[model samples]
Target chain A: MIPIDYYIIVSILLFSIGSAIVFTRRNILYVLMGIELIFNAANINLVAFGQLDPYLNGQLFSMLIITVAAAESVVALAIVIVLFKKLNTIDLNEITQLKEK
Target chain B: MKLIEIVFFFFAIQLLSSALVILFTRNVVYAAIALMSTLLGVAALFVVAGSDLLAVVQLVVYVGGVLILLLFGVLYTYRDPESYFEKKHVLLSIVTVVCIAGALLFLLSDLPFNYPQLETSPHDATGITKRTGYLWITNNLLVFEVVAVFLLVVLVGAGWIASHVLDKSKKDV
Candidate 1:
């Protein structure tokens, strides 16, 4: 079996890539995808660390996180669709800022 | 050298590279598809970590549910493929990614690498599903139930928001 360090390093790399995607991408859907990547990275860490725990608390929490991420994506994407319909574009910079007339 | 080690590295490559593709690919559809492979690779990682249950859930929820939603969003929103993908601050993001990775490795290098070998057998003797179920109904029951309530709320809220939009558009007509 490989050391836990391998998993940890991969998780760190995934998290970094996710962060980069979040910051650099202008498409809101890609931004949502980046958020999912970040969530999965954290899930990997939880499972890897849970392997060290006899009770598997980390795994339980990982399950919780998975459920939450799924729900979050649903709501966020719904919002994205709504925004796209109203704004005509999903580019982060192109979307008009909120201001009252 | 070992089979498991080989599998782990294979998935690790799949996960990392697909993630890179997802970030760099200009085609929104290609990026969405790349995310599928990335999630599957992560599920394999869970198996390597000895959590079969998590692997299955990751596959189901991420690959099946979330990726589908993302692809649908792509289909529904973009009329012209040219305008579908937009990236900003490329060089800055690259520098930030490299800096973050390097700093993390530097931090890791300073820490002692030794870890105590687990006392138990390599695999969990107890079935994780059973244990997870027990925990779900007992200690984690509250949180688990709360999640259910949260899902219900989100479901109703999404429906409400959607119908509200339709009503407004109809009135505008």
Candidate 2:
């Protein structure tokens, strides 16, 4: 079996790249995808560490994480839909009404 | 040189490359497809780690549910696709990512985590799925209930947020 350390590296890489996606992307939809990437990165870490335990707590935690992530995305997409309708645009750059003048 | 090692390497490579695609792609359609690849790779890795149940959950929820919803959302908000990525910060973001990954790798390498190197993962263990279900009901029951309610609230809340507001606005117009 591969050492648990390798999984950590992969998780870290996924995490940093996911952050890059969130940081650099302007589209609300692409940002959501990046958030999903970040979520999966953590899930990978949990599943990897779950191997050390007999009860599989890590897998259980990851299951909950996945469930919440799905629900979160549903609400986010709903907001995106409404935002598109109201503003006629979904670009994060252009929707800056919240910015102070 | 073992099959397990080969498959592990495949998961690692596919995950990293597809994630990079999500980072760099300017086209939203290609980025969405690439996210699908990344999610599939994560599911495979879950199987390799001996959790077939979570692997399947990852598939049904992420690839089937989330990706499709994203595609539908994209269809609704269709525009001439623009730079999801910031062209100006390309080099800066790359440098930041490299720094963060390097720092995390360095920090994580020192953590003591000792486990048996099982030649065959417990992937084929009998009744693992059964055990998972039992444990959920027996031990993690609270999480099960809360998420159930959470999803219900989300369903109604999302409908109200997405639909009801639009109707009021349309009436006003």
Candidate 3:
């Protein structure tokens, strides 16, 4: 049988990688992808623990999370497209025209 | 030794490799493709871990819906891929890596090594589908309906925003 710790370890690794990508990447879309990665990591953990419980609510919640993620991607990608058209660049650094340094 | 063990090992490798490729790739399109692979591997892992519903949902929502939208976003906003290299922040990247490593170390320290003793037989465990279906329709039906409605709204909103941006850009040119 596969151990639960292995799942936990994979989750942590994916989460940390996602965090790293979010912090370090300049592309706003990549940052959003990183956020998705983090969400997936959380979903993995939830499903892993859900396997332990008898009611399977964790599995249900994970499905809900997947739907929410799809919605989030749509909205976020739309915003990114609009921003790219207005500025002609999607780099996070270049989009700081509104910021008062 | 068993088929399950071999399947788990292969899927884990695929998940880790694809995830790393997604992170390290310089091309946005390639990274997106790698992300797809990672998502598929995760879905497989979900199946192995006994959440068949989640596995199907993961495939449909993430791979089918989210990834297509992401690919559309990338294609719509095409810039020179190599032009993105000018704004690298070395110090912040180092700090972020160090902080993540520290957190991972702390989490590793607290994990219990002993596996929990679960008593459900394989045949009975496979009956999760019937149980989950009853729970969904009986008590959680409303939440499911709400999510479907939310997805519809999001689709309309995204289409509107993208088309509006395209029209304005055409007028500008």
TM-score of chain A of each: 0.92, 0.93, 0.91
**How many angstroms is residue B68 displaced in model 1 relative to the true structure, after the best TM-score fit?**
0.7
Q: A1-101, model 2: which lDDT tens digit per residue? A: 57777788899999999888788778898889989999999999999888666787898999999999999999999989878878888888888783222
- Name the weakest run of 10 consecutive residues (lDDT summed) in model 1 chain A: A92-101
Q: What is the interface RMSD of each candidate, in Å?
A: 1.8, 1.6, 2.4
> Candidate 3 residues A1-101, lDDT tens each?
46677787788878877888898888887888898999999898888778877777778898888888888888898888778767777998888774322
List the lowest-lDDT window of 10 residues for candidate 2 chain B.
B119-128
Candidate 3 docking classification: medium
Q: Write the per-residue lDDT of candidate 2 for residues B61-173, one digit (tens) a residue.
A: 99999999999997888777653445676786698689889998888778766677665546455725887899899898998998899999998999999889799878988
Best-fitting candidate, measured by lDDT?
2
TM-score of chain B of 2: 0.90
* Cα lDDT, model 1, residue B98: 93
Which tens-of-lDDT digit does each residue in B1-173 have in candidate 1?
88888999999999999999877877788889999999999999998888899999998888999899999999988756556443455576688689878898889879986666564423477647777778899888899899999989988897777678767766877
Which ten residues in a row are the worst by lDDT in model 1 chain B? B114-123
In candidate 2, which residue pairs get closer than 3 Å at backbone N, Cα or C atoms, i.e. clash? Answer: none
User: Candidate 3 lDDT, tens digit per residue, B38-73?
Assistant: 899999989888777778888888999889888888
lDDT score at residue B163, model 1, on the 0-100 scale: 72
Name the candidate, 1 or 2, with the larger TM-score value: 2
Give a tens-digit lDDT track for model 1, residues A24-96. Answer: 8878888888899999999998988788776779999999899999988988887777777677778888776
- CA error at residue A43 for candidate 2, angstroms: 0.5
